[model samples]
Target: MRTVGVEEELLLVDAESGRPLSVAARTLQYAAEAAEPAEDAGDASIAASGEFAPDEVPGGSIEHELQQQQIETDTVPHTDMAALGEGVRAWRDQAITAARRAGARVIASGTSPLPVEAAIVGKPRYLQMVEHFGLTTTEQLTGACHVHVSVESDDEGVGVIDRIRGWLPVLLALSANSPFWQGEDTKYASFRSQAIMRWPTAGPTERFDTAESYHSLVSAMIASGVIFDKGMIYFDARLSHHYPTVEIRVADVCADAADTVLIAALCRGLVDTAAAEWRAGEEPLALSVAMLRVMSWQAGRFGIEGNLIDPQTLAARPAREIVADLVDHIRPALRENGDEELVERQIAQILERGNGAMRQRTMLEKTGQLSDVVADLATATAGLEG
Candidate 1:
């Protein structure tokens, strides 16, 4: 089985007011301190107060993000779905604890519900981004859930990316979490997707026939000076620069750990299915980039509430039907990995209870307040509510 990992970016907000807070630096400091050895009495006391011990959680990490209003957590790669789920929850707890110590609360929201003037983290690369991109950098405070699945080689990774392009929009629709942005309802299931698409190189890419072609395209893009580096090659799915894996960057940061795990499981299933197809000498779907972009837009607009473009027919269909097809398409892979039952249950739950976007909208409709939406999201993020 291919090992899978997840990286979730969470929004930090004022606990009482439910407004975005710029305390990521302080929260990271607290996390670093908690990870230190408890050599002194005071340190032991702090440890007793529920701060996470570094050794207790292996291969997971909490880190700062480009924006100061959010933090990102990376789960250790795992072949077992249960272990991957536990890693996600543990990291979320670590982030929540650190945010509390910093006088903030962490919520798994793709965009802030309240109005916010995002502060860019004062890193050299980030500073350069702001200088070059101006408003695109200044206004980009969105969060996403990036999943990495291990691949045998770069050729296999590129093959997976190519074969999985059409199905990527379905994942986006399933994990759409951003409904409101800057205190007003954006009326889109995932406004974060819209926000992210503002970047020149931040959407779906054309299929590369081989790994060399993929690398050559990336190198040419970098040499053109349009982007800063290979890191900016923000395709919906691509080969990871540092890892022997394919990174899928389509989904929003889901508020529930179960939802994140489901996405990761489905991603791994897609990679497995794609690799098998490649091995069997199957041809990838020759969808054009323009069509793929339209599919993505539809997913980001309606989520699971309305319709999505069917990758097979290129026709709009009910979201539930499309999602069902996705499950069927990847059923063999899921079953082989011992995740079929869990994925089916989670998909049913998401469809019935609603995804993060629907839940956010439902809260606002029930409470008539966006603050309540944020509060609900915070509770969901902390795993304190069902």
Candidate 2:
């Protein structure tokens, strides 16, 4: 089985007011301290307050983001879905505890519901990005859930990327969580997807038939002075710089742990299916980049609440139908990995309860307040509220 991992970027909000808080540095510091053995009484108190015991899962890390109002949590790659779910929950709990120590609450919302003056982190790379990108960097406080699935070789990875392009919008629709942005209902399910497209390099890419073509394109983009480095090659799906895996970067950071895991499982299935197809000498769908962008826009605009572009037919269809098509396309791989039952169950739950966007809007309808939405997100993020 190919190991899969998840990285979620989460918002830090004031526990009472639900406003975004610039305390990521402090929160990360507390997390680091909690991971180390206590050297003194104060250190012991800090470690004790973390509330979570370290797990045997390796490669898990907590890191600061470009903006001080968010932190990112990474799960170690795992071949088992149950173990992967545990790692996600454990890391989320650890982040919550550390954020509490820093006078903030961790939230799983993709964007803050209330107005926020996002503070840029003081790291040299971040500062340089701010200087180069200006408002694009400052205004980008969006969070996303990225899933990495291991592949045997870069050629296979690129082939998988080429074949998986058409179905990515379905993943985005299922994971759409950012409904409101800067105190207003944006009338879109995933405003974060819209916001991130501001980056020049962020969006769909044309098919790269080989590993050589993929690397050459990335190097050309960087050399053109549009982006700073390979890290900025923000294609919806790309080969990972640090791992022998293909990273799918289209989904929002889901508020529910189950939904996050479901996305990861689906991503792994997609990669595996694509790789198998490539090995069988199948040609990828010749979808144009423009059409893929349109499909992605439709998914972001309505999420599962409206029609989505079908990958097979290239026509508008109900979101449920498209999602079903996605499942059927990857069913074989999912069964091989023992994730068929889990994926089906979770997908049904999401469709019925609605994605995070629907849940957030429901909270607003109940309380008529965005702060309450944030509060509910925090509760859901900590796995306290269903």
Candidate 3:
């Protein structure tokens, strides 16, 4: 089975006021101290003793984002959803604990509930981004969930990406977790999607039938001075430059671990199904980028509450029906991976209880307080406290 990995960005917020805090540097420092090696051994003694090496936390797995208000955690690639869930939960809990020690709380929110004076981290690359993009880069306080599924080759990966582009909006709708932004309900399910769209290279990409074409387009974008680098190729789904995988960058940062697992499972399934089709020499869908953008917007606007543009017909259909179609589309892959039953149950539960956006709205309606919303979100981020 192709392994899947997840990267989630979480906001560090004030425990009492629900305001985002720029304490990621402090929290990471605390984590490092907890994992660092004891200072006692000489270089020769350390070389002699293999066990005395620095017990430091893996720097690459958990790190700061563009802003100090947000931290990102990535899981090891796993073939099983349960293992992925455990990894995600463990990392999240660790982040929360680290933030608490730093006098803040980590909330798995897509956007901050309170207004924030965004503080950019003092990193050279991020500083360049801020200088180039200006306000667009500085205003980024959004968090998102990205799932990476291994692909055998770039050819196969681009093939899978081409076929799977239409189905991404459903994933967006299912993971819609950002309803409130800057203390006001944006009235859109995943307002973070809108916020991130300020990037010139963000959102869906035109079909690149081959790996060569994908590389060509990326090169052209950089050469044209439209983007800083290949990393700015922020398509909804793209061939990962750093990994042998296709990374889907649509969903909001889920408030619950289970939802994150479900998204990962479904994404892996979609990639598998698309690869199978590629093996059978099936032609990829030729959906227009303009239409794909519209569909994406519809999903972010209504989530599962209204209609979504159906992947098959590109016609507006009830969100439930669209979600059902997605399930059927990837059914074979799920069963093959022994995830059919698990994904079905998760999908039913999500449909019944609602996505994070609906739950947040419902909580605010009952409590009539934004702080209550943040409190409930923090509880949910811990587990199933909601």
lDDT (Cα, 0-100) at 333 in candidate 3 = 93
In candidate 2, the residue pairs with backbone N, CA or C atoms under 3 Å apart (3 or more residues apart, or in different chains) clash, namely none
Off by over 4 Å in 3: 36-60, 384-386
The residue-by-residue lDDT of candidate 1 on 1-386, one tens digit each, is 89988889999999999998999989888887776454532211223222345345323667778899988888767899898888788778878888999999999988998899969999999999999999999999998999999999999999999999999999999999999988889989999999999898888988897999999999999998989898898889989887788999999999999999999999999999999999898999989999999999999999999999999899999999999999999999999999999999999999999999999999999999888999999999889973
lDDT digits (tens) for residues 48-120 of candidate 2: 2323343422247777788999988887788999988888888888899899999999989889999999599
Better of 1 and 2 by lDDT: 2
Lowest-lDDT window of 10 residues in candidate 3? 41-50
- When summed lDDT is taken over every stretch of 10 residues in candidate 2, the lowest stretch is 41-50
Q: List the residue pairs that clash in candidate 1.
A: none
Q: Kindly list the per-residue Cα lDDT of model 3 for residues 1-386, writing each as its tens digit.
A: 99888889999989998888899899887766554343432111111111221223111255779999988877767788998888888777778878899888888878887788879999899999998999999999998999999999999999999999999999999999999887899989999999989998889887888999999988999999879788888888998877889999999999988999999999999999999999899987778989998999999999999999987787899999999999899999999999999889988999999999998999899989888888888898988563
lDDT of each: 0.89, 0.90, 0.85
* Model 2: lDDT to the true structure: 0.90
After aligning candidate 3 to the native by TM-score, how far in Å is the CA of 158 from where it should be? 0.4
Q: Cα deviation in Å at residue 38, candidate 2? A: 13
Q: How do these models rank on lDDT, best leading?
A: 2, 1, 3
lDDT of 1 at 186: 92
TM values, all candidates: 0.94, 0.94, 0.93
